[model samples]
Target chain A: MNQRNESVEMDNQLAEFSDRILNDEETARAEGLTGELADLEKTVLRLNAAASQEALNEAQSKRMLLRLKERMRREQEEKAPFWKRFFNPQFGFLVVAAALTLFLVVNAPAVVNPDLSGTATSKSGVYVAAGVLTLFMAAYWLMRKK
Target chain B: MQNNSPHQQEISDEVLIRRYLNGEVEVFDLLYYRHLPKVHKRVRYVIPPNDVEDVTQEVFIAAVKALPSFRGDAKFSTWLRTLTNHKVAEYYRKRSRKQEPQIAALTETLAHPDNLSFHSVEERIYLQRALMSLPENYREILLLRFAEGLQFNEIAEAGNRNLEATKSLFRRAVTALRHCLEE
Candidate 1:
């Protein structure tokens, strides 16, 4: 036969072979071919996997372990203790400065004498002390209303 | 209605991906198991037998890693095939730079069994080698039809061509396969 005719014959044979393998009536009826097909497939896959190249090795495993450890360490770092949350020096400084500023704003007038001990107390200090007292009184009244 | 209700198994790729992003890694595995065979077959279509499994693993790994970034615009399978194409191109790129002796070395690695049926693994390997000998476009259509078991319409969609074009391409691919098998 010519090369072309031989190829045509091979194609036909391939198709017929597939049909026979799939349509094994005796095996299908006796043993459930679908299940057999699945099992056979599993075997084929297992064989392929066994003979196939492996993705694992000591180097790759060590790299993966290192990655896992690093990620865990990162997660642990994320979940820091409550005290450690304040470990940020800049943020702590900002917080302390804010707290001191707030304390000075609230209590500075209390230290100043609104009623002057002597004539050394200027009129401006007296006015400033009065404004602070008035603000505090208003804030206290609003809180009481709430 | 109760009997016909679709379970999580029946849920579409979009929903499954949504579940995956919602913190279910196992859902990705389910999707992987569902799609791996087709991906494996497609990889088998393009490359030689020795490299097919490696390509398959690469495809799966890429897919799994990129799942979180999937934007739900394209169909999951289409996106996956696109990724497959990219890997195939990369393989060819790496392959083209290598010397022929290295490729020839792969021939020895092919297990040639005697007394083989046409349906046997040996024959399949032979057929795969023949398919790989064809041009990239011809190989793609043959792989889509035979290995991947996609319809002509699906091939057209994957090829981004019309149905008639895809049909003619597939016929030509089969004809080419016949010629290759003869050679």
Candidate 2:
């Protein structure tokens, strides 16, 4: 047989041998098996050990469950309508900041025009504070998206 | 239902899933705890140790989202195992996008002080190192068969291969792992 066919037959034999050994089925001695099959059995034992390692303790499991609960809550909120979503305080803050920006822009001329002096500086200061707050909120939203 | 209660312990996963779908959300906690160790072990085989918990959590979250579509043709544990595998694969895809190091480097960082008791810490580390040297497909097949306790036919179905091909693949995978361990 060609090398490819030979190798496949060998693999088939090895697989059967390993299965019999693993299942503790009575079989003739494995005298004709290649050394690779013996080494493979040893490796399988070690791999099984490595794979079955216990990493989660009760406390860690509880902590993971808690996080999953929080995630489920967040996902549920995300699935809500826009109006429902805005009910969240974080979204409410964004909406309030957006409204303040619109109000300040519309009222800007009255507060800081050259036609109106004296109080223009203080009124402009108010606009500037509002502008800074709007900018901060916008930046926060952008950063969160990033 | 409270997980520790004797009543809850007697309920099967399918029954719990049905209850959860019927709006008894507390039943999900029982499912979560029931399958946590299985999911955790499965994820750890393919993912970096530090990321295993997060990936495991993501798996259940995915399961919760996908639960509505489940038709109960297979056991819930089988469905969850498939989901866990998908999440682990997704994690590797994301890591590759960010140009992270290879699996060997990730496995090297898996040596937490707490995991030393499974064997001599050295032997565990050696086995992990050997596993990291293997191709991803080989490692996955070995894990599904041995660690996940999948029969050869189940593995064939999962991988879309014929039973003989799957057995041949398993034998080759074991041989490759043996060579790596020897090295």
Q: List the candidate 2 regions with Cα displacement exceeding 4 Å.
A: A1-34, A52-54, A86-146, B1-6, B101-141, B150-169, B179-183
For residue A25, give model 2's deviation from the true position in Å: 16
Q: Give the CAPRI rating of model 1.
A: incorrect
**iRMSD for each candidate structure, in the order shown:** 11.8, 3.9
Model 1 C-alpha lDDT per residue in residues B1-183, reported as the tens digit of each score: 012235755989899889889997657655765666667667655565556656766676677668889998998988898889888778877777774422442453544423223234444454555666778798767556555567557778878998666655654565666567657
**Candidates' RMSD to native:** 15.3, 9.7
lDDT minimum window of 10 residues, candidate 2 chain A:
A21-30
Where is the poorest 10-residue window by lDDT in model 1 chain A? A43-52
Each candidate's number of clashing pairs is: 0, 0
* Candidate 2 CAPRI category: acceptable
